[model samples]
Target: MSEIPANTRPLEGPAPRLKAPAGATDCHIHLYLPGYEAQPGGPKIPELATVEDYRKLQQWLSLERVVVTQPNAYQRDNRALLAALEQLGPDTARGVAAVTPDTPDRDLQAWHDRGIRGARIMNLPGGAVTHADMLAVEKRIRPLGWHLMVQFNGCQLNDYIDNLQRLESEYIIDHIGKFMPPVPADDARVDDILRLLDRGNAWFKICAGYEASLTSAPEYADVGAIARRVIAHAPERIIWGTNWPHVGVSRDNYPSDADQLDVLLDWATPEQQQKILVDNPARLYGF
Candidate 1:
């Protein structure tokens, strides 16, 4: 009954119907603490969602681990993300950072020591890094055992699959590869995604169905089909997330964290759910 925190959105509802396994991880979230202004070209969202706010969400989801992604709004600045990780504790939280080509290796090393396991390429609009920076970042973070996490228009994934395969470090494609307009279940792009997984070079984060869904909220049947395809192909390689704060997405369409977790029950079996929600992230993020 205490006053709700300022500058943050509330959880959609109560805890989910599906009980999460112990050590489950929400692998893709962002932190926007107060006073951290967005850079000139970064993605914009109103207000800030702090680590403290997200912990309430974790408790609601019955999740113990998290991966706080560096949002495009912060561009190459990782100070806010690092602070969130510090608060979440190294054992229960990991992070994916956004860094520019000019960022020093020492800085990257420092981020690694702080529990960042991946370097993110926000390939969408307002992103600071680009495709050109992928190989360079791979070269830099490979020594530290970090992979490259990428978010972009899913239509273009095939164009970069070969490039992604060649990188020495492992990689991840965000949001079911986030195919815009929601490609057909049999679309060649889906095949390409399967191929990328088969090649054993990359992983997929099954988050943000609304980002690519042509259908309405709660079900997102179109994107759900894509998620099933990816999970059917390799449950061991798939991870789940809330895409918390749901930036750029309208509130009316934004799903509750519980609803987001419930959708998985419709996609994968209980065992597969454990792998996606708990086991896979354990291997990928070292939880």
Candidate 2:
């Protein structure tokens, strides 16, 4: 085990000036417990985030649905993530789990029955899955009606475009594929993302703007432009999330839950906002 941050900040902040529509969902977030060890050779996301702590955030943001992603901190150890889904209740909360290609069929079915709608493969540095395992993992989850939620660098997506198109399961590209240095609006990466959305089997999470932006938080202007382009390309495929507890984020730069939600107003129209925050997530997560 490694040292985890205290995360003393209250989950309180200014209310988003734009209220989230009914059934609005935070499609990406995590739960962390102290003293838990990361998988060997995996990225460290040591932090103390709990479901109860996140309830305060849910109230602050007025979001009714959530999807708890199994974090790299507890790679392949989904006990905490499963507990969170139970605590949040299956009716309003769903989960995206981390599993190896070898994870048993029985276990996968159990997780699916308990409200896990997706399996995530973090291809970023220190992520659990390798490039070679992407399709194998997708094959494992396909039978369960779960999509593959992939997190990777935008610049690298083109490399896997052929594999992505061939996967039998529907897929979600996390954080607009987390484009680095926030590329130009017309960058080829943007077109690749658009092409993925055009396939009708893919979805995008319009979360974690700060991670992809060269600009700092509260504004995140450059990443916001890319997100806007994604929305313009396909509002129906875009869903919103706060990336709460902001694991691995420096506390000084970690944003308020409300501030993160407010950024969406700039990204979409009120009707588009409704689709991103509510309807789209409902369809994706089965809320």
Candidate 3:
């Protein structure tokens, strides 16, 4: 196994169960890249989710492709995530990087070579991310044909939908709009998600983000609703994942890798299920 920063690392509990169908991909997952110190006010290293742990988890899930997301902990130093892509190799996996406006073209090209199709601008901690920040990053990444993968919560994407949609780059939503089911369609924020889909290039990940609060087997209401709503908006763009190791976040029901896959099966029909689990990601990530 490769050495990660000591402070941020995986707490391996059990060997994971992959059990996914052939050509399946987990649209979302994180690689803990600790040890890289951050400048003041920059992103902090949350917890490390090792690639080696995920590789075994992928085998357990029966998946061949994965999208490695750089977490808040590593800040903007994506070398760790890039290294994880290198570990994943050329044929099987790809990544979505977390980069700032200042990331060099060489570095971006380097990531492209390592199977990165996009750059991420995580905005999960409320209004901390500004549109100006996104606009600046847009200028940096769109020219490369890379998409923008965003992680945010609160008010759906309605607040930023127009700006997000108008951009030329493809927009991939994180965690089913972070909608909590049984919450009112008005407050449910499904409209905001639907609006992004109306733009055509926008996509969504039917993932187990901690905010969704999933129960292992028999399913959880939040994630199932998220999947249903996303598929309703754009089944072709919807995808599934475990968000492995859970990160700085925790879950209500800690599902094993298999437990997570079952969430998708429960939410969509067999064919749509294949789109969420296998086909959609292959098209989006070119897997």
Candidate 1 TM-score, true structure as reference: 0.95
Better of 1 and 3 by TM-score: 1
Model 3 segments more than 4 A misplaced? 1-19, 33-48, 126-130, 154-156, 180-182, 185-188, 214-218, 250-253
lDDT of all predictions = 0.84, 0.84, 0.68
lDDT of 1 by residue, 1-287 (tens): 12323554775467798899998899999888876777768866476788878888888889889999988888888888898889889989999988666778899888988999998887778877888888887888888899888888888876777777788777888888888978877899889888888878689988988778889777889988888888998988899999998888666665677888899989999999999999999998877
* Candidate 1: residue 275 Cα off by (Å): 0.6
* Candidate 1: clashing pairs of residues: none
Candidate RMSDs in order = 3.1, 1.7, 4.0
Give the candidate order by descending TM-score: 1, 2, 3
Weakest 10 consecutive residues, lDDT, candidate 2? Answer: 38-47
- Displacement of residue 287 (Cα, Å) in model 2 is 0.9
* Cα displacement (Å) at residue 255, model 1: 1.8
Number of backbone collisions per candidate = 0, 0, 12
Query: Superposing every Cα of model 1 onto the true structure, what RMSD results?
Result: 3.1
- List ranges where model 2 is wrong by over 4 Å: 1-6
